[model samples]
Target: MPDLRKEIINILDGKLLTPHFQPIVSLTHKKILGYEALIRGPSNSPLHSPFNLFTTAERFNLSTKLEFLCREITIQRYADLDIKEKLFINASPLVLLQPEFKKGETLRLLDQYGVNPRSVVIELTEHKPADNYEIMRASAKHYRGMGFEIALDDLGAGYSGLRLWAELLPEYVKIDKHFVHSLHNDPIKLNFVRSIQSMAVSLNCSVIAEGIETQEEFKAIEKIGITNAQGYYFARPTAVPVKEIDKALFAIEQDTDCKSAPFNNATTAVQIIRDITPISAKTTISDVMNLFHHNSELTILPLVDDNIASGIIFRDKFLTKLFSSRYGIDLHGKNPIKMFIENTPLCIDKNMPIDLVSKQLTSLMTNDPAFIITHNGEYMGVGTLLDLLAEFTRQQIDNAKHANPLTLLPGSVPINNQINQLLANKIPFGFGYFDLDNFKPFNDVYSYDAGDAIIKAVANTLIQYIPAESGRVGHIGGDDFIVIFTCDDWLTRCKNILKAFESTVPSHYSDKDINAGGIHTENRAGEKCFFPLISLSVGLVDPVSTSQCQSHVDIADLASEAKKMAKKIPGNSLFINQRMAAKNSGNFQSFTHSATKLHIVN
Candidate 1:
């Protein structure tokens, strides 16, 4: 014990703490959101492990001093390295309330190190139960008042996770590593995370999934719609963490997964972002009043903390309350704007579908009719309900015009629009052409009504099986459909659709034909032959680079050729086009129409 105390003292006096950084990445944007500043003792010391170092310090009643040293070192090193993203520094509640903890000590350190308070998130770590909620709340607010965001770290591992969350209302909550490890295979764990995500959404906060160490775990989190994540899967803690995401990881995210599946050409909140400058929560209310007086057109004031949209202040509401009492302005004008800010204001991610945003706005009973727009939980701009309605209505009218009357799915025109958009954006995606086999014979036997049902069934299967965020389904008339898949597991989705179609087709057939395994029908040559039951054939074209294909026309030609290949098979089949690969290998040229048209307009 004496030896440990001496080592601790020497370490503190010598300032020998090493600050290592681990990246916190955004799965949605495929970029580094920030880094958590983790402290380590000397490599050869017995107190090398953070847990042992901190526990021994606590045992010797030097916790506050040690924690302060860690903070100073972290802030200084973070600025020295010139990292651009936010820096998360862990702060225990006990250290925060200690008598020796100076009121402006952290602020002084930040200013000395040239680190912006807005780029730092004070991650509250509960080394033990924190029974004093009021003091903890006050401490958290102090940091928040300085433009720093608060985050509850290792949520489930703490003794009073929900209580602390409710008391402090942190801007971010990190799900404990225990809940995220092997999350893909554990249904209960997944459910816990989903519930946490749902709660965060409702509370207008962000959830960061921690300790994701495997690809399957990340895929599961992506599917669950969690945006920010931290784990070894991305990178481990080091003196100098990776500044840019790995290209392979970026490709995996882009080609296979989306936190929120946005259809090709889908309108998102970003389209309606109004260029509005946000105010820091620490801005004086009098300053806000002066601005409102100067700009009559401005109606809403967005409150941002550490780049996160924390709340909003309505121009009219704030003014009315201030003057409702004679001494209101005199009493509250000097107070920070956050004291009167609307904590529950609507905040929408920029990538959210406009239709969904419209739905959210309409469901709310608030009369302000405004929302703050964010990108990966960072403030981007503000949007109003009026603009959202206009955009959503435009989309609806446009979709209705190009929709197939039979299936109400996107028809040829919209299909072309989607394809053109994908090509223009240079987004990598698989294209699948769907066609029904033995359809003409089925129409002959069952009539147009039954044939329509069959076509609708195929459309339903495609829509049901394909994930909406990564794939878009379209009807190209009759039994022909098209699916554009940005998800990596497109082949699996296609096979599932085939299996579903096979299961349902038998019910559409009579028992005698079912027993016969087919129907004896007249062939195109007028000869009687056995026609098998209607089956689906899917031809998939792997993601082709924009350099290889000029437009949707080129893709259509390649996919159509693949569809023909699939049709030649005996039964339901999926044929993947490898022309792109073969062409790259110098075995084949680019696929194009066989004959050129000679214009003969009369």
Candidate 2:
């Protein structure tokens, strides 16, 4: 062990530690946001892992040297790689006390290597409390003043990180790996991270869920609105930052978790009042008053009697009663706040749906400043109507982004998203893949406006025929459409869609075409031909009938095969992949008019 310490120190002296870069993705933007610089000691050495290397250096009293060397190498290599994205460099708070740290060599090195200070975020890694909060604050402020951002690293796993958060107000706070691990299985961890996120938002800071190696954990974080993600789920740390995502990780849809919120109401209510501090009901008005005066941000206090919300008291009303009367404090300060609690304070059970709460909020009188949220008769927290409205607005924005602009129906993203959810839950449903036949020839002859009319008409038919409660329609660009049917009568409804499409499409054609049974047009390659009125080719895939379809991609591909089989038959066809299809009818002779007139469009 003693020999290992010297070996580690020698490794640092020779700069044997190189920075391995891990990419951080923005779950919201679905793009690479930045890279975190992780240092790795040389291979085949006891110091190969950063954990082992740093621990050995600390045992040898060379922790500062090792940490500084790590930072130096990270800055040098990251700049050399010309990574313009923000580079997060880890720095132990303990090292801030060193004299060399004060000389600003790191900033100079950044400049020397063409890395801008603005592009750097020094992650304050603390396994133990700093020697002095003032020194920590001052040191962090110094770098931040020079365009460097600060981040509190391994937040839940470290000592005094919450205090550091308050003292330094780091630009970003990365929830520890412990908090992120198995998050899908732990409600406590999810709530904890959510609380941290709410506080971080209030502080105007970002939350990065780090060490995310599983899809469940990644989705768990995104579902709660933490968008900045760094984890092996996205990319493993490599000597070179992942400039392009690998195929295995590619197309992993981000920001689709808004719909994954547990039972909507359950998840939404937890988000509200998540940051408010609860007080014991037995507490005196004097103590409550003191808390109110000291913490100006305090608005509503939930009086908890044995963890159950006995009542809620608003700050302004409580203070008003005390201050309005000169002897009010002397008379009642010693008494419990339960007596002063509002007679009609808006109390809501935490299990109530957010929409139900929103309705109650709108009906409540003005004096009810806050709503008391209780779980199993115990005080959970206090929520304002504002919080509920904000959540509502957020959901709306998320929904709008997934919708298709042309049809106002959900586009490809939502179609795939809903399919993923259904398959993940093993729900039986019908996926209808719709493509228009002769649409290209029709659009070519009639112009794009008429092409759009047919698309809109096809969309309208899908909407009208598909039962609203049991079906969702999606426009997957151009003339392609998708319908996910949750009802048992999906087959009948899909038949209705084809029937409606066939009957209505002829109306879009000119009087001459209607009499002619379709229009005459020249398709690509400049060949003159007679094309039938626009008809739909629907590929119906009963995913549950066969072994479950693997993914949305598989679902689409299978449906496409069925659709190709359908289009081979001519006008208005329904091809179900795992069953019978409409094909080889006499309409084929009328549809082709001439084989030279044909073209395929999906």
- Per lDDT, the best of the predicted structures is 1
Which of the numbered candidates is closest to the native, going by highest TM-score?
1
Candidate 1, residues 460-550: lDDT per residue as tens digits? 8888888567688999888899988878888778777777788889888899998998888888999888898888877778875322677
> 413-496 in candidate 2: lDDT tens per residue?
757766776676566677778898888888887889988888999889888877555667889789989888767787677766
For candidate 2, the lDDT comes to 0.72
- 69 in model 1: Cα distance from truth in Å? 8.7
lDDT of each candidate versus the true structure: 0.79, 0.72
Residue 284 deviation, candidate 2, in Å? 46
- Would you list the clashing residue pairs of candidate 1? 256-488, 261-469
At residue 10, candidate 1 shows an lDDT of 92
Per-candidate TM-score against the hidden true structure? 0.62, 0.47
